[model samples]
Each structure stands twice: as structure tokens, then as C-alpha cells.
Target chain A: MYKEPIFLQPKFQERIWGGKKLHTEFNYTIPNDQTGEAWVISAHPNGPSVIKNGPLAGKTLADAWNDHGELFNKSKDNHEEYPLLVKILDANDDLSVQVHPNDTYACEVEGVPYGKTECWYVLSAEPGAELVIGHHAKTKDELTAMVENQNWDTFLRRVKVTAGDFVYVPSGTIHAIGKGIVILETQQSSDITYRVYDYDRTDSVGNKRELHLDRAIEVTEVPHQDADKEQSVSTVHQLTVKKLVEEKYFTVYHWHLFGQASELKLNQDFLQLV
Target chain B: MIDGEATLTVDGKTFEVEKGSHFILPHGLSDYDLSGDAEFIVSHV
Candidate 1:
């Protein structure tokens, strides 16, 4: 009997290199505050209600999935459909050079059901903000040589990204969100980023995260390009799909909201918190 | 005896959904279909 829209909060992680950047979680009313932790949002394996509202008011998302699995018709092996993962990435420093695997590859190689294909809506970027996307090298050996030689400037396709730009990153596209950029990312519910190159940074324990050079090479796609397509769809309301970034798996619509009540028919059982 | 059901009438047409069974009445669906005594959950997307 709830009349208002339900909102979910994005759990934040305090990394060793993380700055004073706090993730602002909006539109979620989870019952258990403990579920939103530092690194990940815990979808209780035992099944309990984490959020307080929506069509699934009293039931946990897991319980709902268990009982109404027929609604989604998910396979026997896969459980997660659409997990809520949002990040307010404060790239205070450069992130590792990374690429993502597709669902099929992840399932076969990594034994995971889903792969990550994400979109970035640039909220703001400091002047001279740049992002490394795709490989300047055409072959895997060439990229390997560049990385070993530390020829980063030649190996990366650096773009001066600014606020209000929408970027869609397909799986296998080697990319990195550079320093001084903060973004709101929405993507398929998966967490399998293969870091090809890290700037030789170490964790608090002085242990560096292993670079999956061979795996990344296998997954990396050559010739990464930006989606420079304009938001051309005309609508009466200010709500328009300004930019659309699509990969083989999921499509992200960079929506431009300007105080308009938007109406949309549900395609899959989508969870939209605010 | 069958479990109690509710039939919802909208614009002269009716929709009968059982307590356990549900139907998605598509957006802009002018005509609806039903049997008189079925109960259901209704929502617009």
C-alpha cells in the first residue's frame, strides 16, 4: 500500500588510495542498515528483508527470487538477475588499466553467470581530466611490449572527458577512469574487472593487486572508440535518453532529467530506487 | 471447493486472476479478459 517511490543506497568502500569522497546513497530504504557495508552490498544468502518498501515490502530480494523464480525464469545455475551496484567514483588518482569479460566468457573461464558492461555519466571532472580507453596497440603483443616499456602515453587513447558526457564501455574494451573525474556508473550486476596494468600501487599491507595480464589479453578487444552519438530522441517531457551506450550484453540510457514525471513500462523486473 | 477468487471489472471488461496466479495487464490495454471470481495483484509496470 505504499504510494511513494522506494530508494536504495549505494554501499561505499574506503580504499587505501581513496580520498575524502563519500558516496551519496539516495532512493533506498533498506530495513537492515548493516547490509550496506564498506566494500559490497550483502544480498543475504539466508534470505531476509533488507529494504522496507516497494512491491517486495516485507520479503528479501533473495526470498522473492526463491519464491517467484517463475516470474523471471532464471536458469538453474544463475541466481542474480539485476543486482544494484552504483558507485560515485572519485578518481583522485588513476585506476588500473582494466577490461571486463562478457557473460559467456565469464561463465566458461571464471565460472560466473554475469559479466560487467558499464556506462559512465560524468557528473564533474576537474580541468584537464582525462580517461584512458581502448588500446593504442592493434595486437596483444604490441600492448604487452608497450606496458613492459612503460610507453603509457603511446599505448592509451586518452580523452579529455568533462561533465555531462555519457560513456558506454563494452566488455573486453581496455579502459580506465583517470584522475580528477567523478562519475555515476550503472551496469549489469557483475564484478569481474580484470586489471591488466596497475600503476605499481600497493595496498595497505604493501601487497599489490595481481595484474591479470594473460587473461586481460584474452578478453581485451582492440580499437576502442567513444560513443559520440547525440541525444536526438524528442519527447514532450524533459526526460530524454540523451546518450545511449550499448555493448553485446546490456544497454545503458544516459537519461537527462529536468523535473518531469517519467512513465515507462517495465521490461524485466527492474528495481529503480528513486 | 476452489479457493476464493476476485474478478476485477474495468471499462466493462473483466479480469480474473487467482490468488497465486497473476497477469500483467499491458499498458494501453483497452480491453480486458476474465472469469468472474478470481483475485489478483494489479499494477502499472
Candidate 2:
């Protein structure tokens, strides 16, 4: 049985809309100037974090979940890939407007265990930074017409945001993180995305990225449904515990402590970040 | 996180945690102690 906390080394990903804030702000040794994301506490096959402390040092987080199921209170026969992924995304440029399929669609069409239902906690945003959280289309045909007409200004719904703001993005919500904003995202351990818009931006190689309008439109909710989350705060041994969101996929908390907090326990699973 | 340092005690073992430090206190960890000063954002499923 492991008695010490498990530290992890993040795995970084390069992206077209990335920047160097992962290095500048978080002090991480990023791979390049376009270091877009840091998979901080992830076990997904795409970018699993490596353990950095105790007897499991140098093992991948996937290893811990696979080899030591008891560490997460899972049975030895449990074969589900670790279910949650935590990431820090630095959007130097706007991300592509995208949506994800639900779990049923993912299992039937994409043959995956889970779909993507993510939530973002804004870490920082420029003075005038904005985000695309929903769309203005009221029907499937209207949404398709807008996407086909290249009418982004009329089709997208924008919201201004700042540091410490939180947004819940369930599956099929058309969303994008605008430029000059950084966020911590928690979501189901899946990476299936369908892009609808990319601002007509070309990559360094002068090639345009693919747009999955057909799938995106097919999966998107006809009428955008805003996720209204109720938050509550309390004190646990002097630690201010703010329950951020409790949902079917993930439950998050923001904790603040100036002096000391004692006797924090966990019999399930946990991830901690600054 | 703010500028500060703290010692996290778990099962009689202590680990130093500061700004930008991330860790997980896996399942079966019943009790842990923290002292000094620091901030953390934790998640679970």
C-alpha cells in the first residue's frame, strides 16, 4: 500500500493557438513557444502524466490506474481507463469553435468509452478577453445555414470573462476559448472533438485545419442550453472549501488557506493543483 | 498560488509543498495534516 501523496510530471502539447504562458506563468519547462496545453493530472492514453514521487516515481499515471486499482478503490477486474482528465490550456489565439458527442454517441459511432463534458475555471484573461460559450441559432437548419454561409458574427454568442470565472460546458455545447486567456479544464477522459469554425486561420505550413461541420451540427443541441450551476462554500479545518460544480462526470472544489488545514482525507480519488 | 510554503503531513510522512506544486493523495489516505501557508485547487470524480 502506498502511503505518500503521488506527484505528477505534466505532459505538454503543441497547438496552433498556443503560447508560452505555461512556462512564464506556471514556471513549467514548456516544449516551445506554442506550448498550448499541460495535461497536469491525466491518465488518458494520448498524454498521461508520469509519477514523480515515492515508490511509483517514474511510472505513468496509467500504470498506477492499471496496476494498482486499489489506489483508486477499483477492483482488479475493472478495465475502465482512468475516467477524468485535468489540463491547463493557454489560448494565445482563439480556439476553433467545436462540440463533442455524448457518451451514447461516442460508444455507438466513435467506439469510445466516454464523451467530452468539460468545465473551465478561468485562471487569467486579458482586459477585453471574451469567450464563445453558445450559439444564436434556434434550429438545426438555421445552424447549418449559418455555418455554411460563413456567418460567424451572426451565428456565435460571445461572453466577456475575467480571472476566477467558471463555465460549465456539457457535451454538444458549441464553445471556444478566446485569445489571451488561460484556463484549467476538467473533463471526461475523451478527446473526440468536432470543429465548426476556425477563423479561416492557416497554420505555419499554410494549410487549413479540417472542419467537422456535419458531425458538429448533427450532435449540437438545436437550442443552446446554458448550464446553470449553483455553488456553495464552507469551512473545513480553516480551509475555505468552495464547491465549484457537482455533475455526472466530475466534481470540483476550489480551496483557499492562509494559515493551516489539518486532517484532510480521501478514500476515493483526488487531484490537487495550485 | 500565493507566495508561501507548507508542509503536508500524511501518515507520519511530511512533504514540502509550495506554489506551482501539484500532487494527489490517492485512495485509502484517511488523514493528512497541512501547516505553514499555501493554497490549493482540488478535484475528484
Best by DockQ: 2
lDDT of 2 by residue, A185-265 (tens): 989999999999998899989999999988999999978988989999998776788889999988887877766787876
Candidate 2 wrongly placed segments (more than 4 Å)? A271-274, B1-4
Off by over 4 Å in 1: A1-4, A23-49, A54-63, A68-80, A225-230, A246-248, A257-274, B1-45
Work out how many backbone clashes candidate 1 has. 8
On the 0 to 100 scale, the lDDT of residue A94 in model 1 is: 79
lDDT of 1 at B4: 34
Measured by TM-score, how close is model 1 to the native structure?
0.68
Error of 2 at A258 (Å): 1.4
Candidate 1 lDDT tens digits, A40-140: 22233322224344575555445545554543344467656534344455666777888999888989998877777767767668999988777788777
Q: Please provide the root mean square deviation of candidate 1 (C-alpha atoms, Å).
A: 10.9
What is chain B's TM-score across the candidates, in the order shown?
0.38, 0.81
Compared with the true structure, the alpha-carbon lDDT of candidate 2 equals: 0.87
Instruction: Give the Å error, residue A240, model 1.
Output: 3.8
TM-scores of all candidate predictions against the true structure = 0.68, 0.96
